[model samples]
Target: MSDNDSQKRAQFLAAYDEQLRTDAETPSAIKVIVQGPLRLVTFLNGRGFITYKNLGGADQAAIQRLVPEAMAYYQADAEIIRVEWKTRGHDHAPGMHEALIDNGFIRDEQESIMIGEASALAVDVPLPEGVTLRQVTEETDVRAMSAMQDEVFGDPVSDDMAEALLRRLAIDPGMELWVAEVEGRMVTAGRLELVPGTKFAGIWGGATREEWRGRGIYRALTAARARSALNHGKLLIHSDSTEFSRPILERSGLLKVSTTTPYYWKR
Candidate 1:
C-alpha cells in the first residue's frame, strides 16, 4: 500500500480499540491469563469466548485439541453454548480458521482493523443543544453507562452485566466511560481505555439514541475521548466498529488497516 493508503488504514484501527481497565466488561469471553499446559481464558455470557496469549509454541494439532476441552468447560453451564474465537490478523494464528470451521464455527462479518495517530482523531466536534459530556467514575454512573450501552447495541437489558460493570468500576480499573447527556438523559455513550503496555487507547461502545442520531454527538464524544487519550501520552486510538461507526471514523481521517472476522462455534 502507498503511504496515504497505509496511513488511512492505521487511523481507522486506532479509533476502534477500547482501553483496558476494571470497568471493561469481562464478557465471560475474557480469560484471565494463568499458568497451565495450555493457558486459556474463557468468557461465558450467552455464548462462550476463548482468548489465549502467545501459545508456548504449541503446534496446530495441539491447538486444535483446545476447542473440545474449552467446549466441555462451558458445556455444562446453561448460560453458554456458543463461543467466539477472536483472531488478530497479525498474530501467527496457524490453523485457526480451519480449526474453527471444522468445528461448526460460522464467521461474522469482517471488520477493518483501523489504527492511526490519536492527533488525527482530535479534530473538533460541535455538541448538540442541551447535550454535554462527563467521565463516569461512580458505580451508579457505571451502571447507567452499561444500561445505555445495551440499549445502543439493541441487546435486552442485562442487569447482571450492568451490575458486573459497576463492580469493576468500584475496583477502580482506570477505564473511563463518557456519555453525551441531553437534558438529564444519556442519549449517546462511549468508553476510552489506555492500554498499560502499548502506545494505544481504545474507544468502544459508541452509540446514540434513534431520535438523537446524526446531530454530531457521537463525533463530539469521540473527539473528547481523543483529547483525553492525548493527555495520557497515548499516540494512537483504536476501535472495531460496525458499519454505522466505520464511516464516521473514516471521515475523521482514521485508517482501516486490515480486517477482523470473529468465527463462532457452539458445543
Candidate 2:
C-alpha cells in the first residue's frame, strides 16, 4: 500500500476504535459491567460478550491476569451459558491468544473489519433476474430470513436467533432487516443498524444462498441498506465481514481497517 493509503487506513481504524468500541457495540445488552477497560456485556439468549476499546498498554502478565478474571466473572453467572471475547488485530495486548486458550476459550475464524462512507455503497445496482429486495418487518418474514441465514451459514435452523431479533426490533427501531427474494423465497439477507449518538451504521448478518452466489443480488441488497442508512442520517458504514463478503465491500469502497476474532467459551 502507498504511504497515503496507509495513513487513510490508520485514520479510519482510529475513528472506528474511538466511536464503535464502546456502548455503540452493546446497545441492547441486558447488562454491562465495566472492569477497567473491558466492557463485559450480557445479552439475551444466555450470551455474554467481552470487548475493550484498548487494553491500556497492558503487558503480557497483566493480560494473562485479566483473561481469567473476566472468565470468572461470566462463569459465576450460571445464566450465561456461553461467552465471546472479541479481539481485534490492531490491539496491542500481548499473550492474549494464549491467555484466552488457557482459560478454555476457543478461537473462531477471523473477519475483516470493513469501514467506509455509506454514500459510497448507496449507489444503484442491478439485481439478478427475478430477484427482488425488500425490508422485512413481519414475524413470519423475519423467521424465514433467519432460517435461510442459518442454513447458508451451515447451522441448524432454529428460532433462537429469530426470537432474539424480534426482541431487538421491539426496542431498537433503528435496526432494519433487509432481504432479497426470488419467487417468494429468500435468497439473501442482512441488517442495517443505525447507531444512536454516532455517525456510523452497521451492515451485519450478510448471507446469500449457495445457488445465489456470484450474482449481484447481495450487492444490490447492500445498496438498499446503505441507502437506508444514509436516509437515517448515518454517514459511515461498518461491518465485520467474512472472506466471502469482504471483497464485495472492498469493491464498494469500504476499507479493511482491521480484523476481529471472537474466542468462545461455553459452560
Q: Note the Cα lDDT for every prediction shown.
A: 0.70, 0.93
| Best candidate according to lDDT | 2
lDDT of 2 by residue, 62-85 (tens): 999999889889889889899999
Task: Judging by TM-score against the true structure, name the best candidate.
Answer: 2
Worst lDDT run of 10 residues, candidate 1, spans: 20-29
Residue-level error in angstroms, candidate 1, position 52: 4.7
Model 2 / residue 217 / CA error / Å: 0.6
List candidate 2 segments past 4 Å from native.
Answer: none
**Candidate 2 TM-score to native:** 0.98
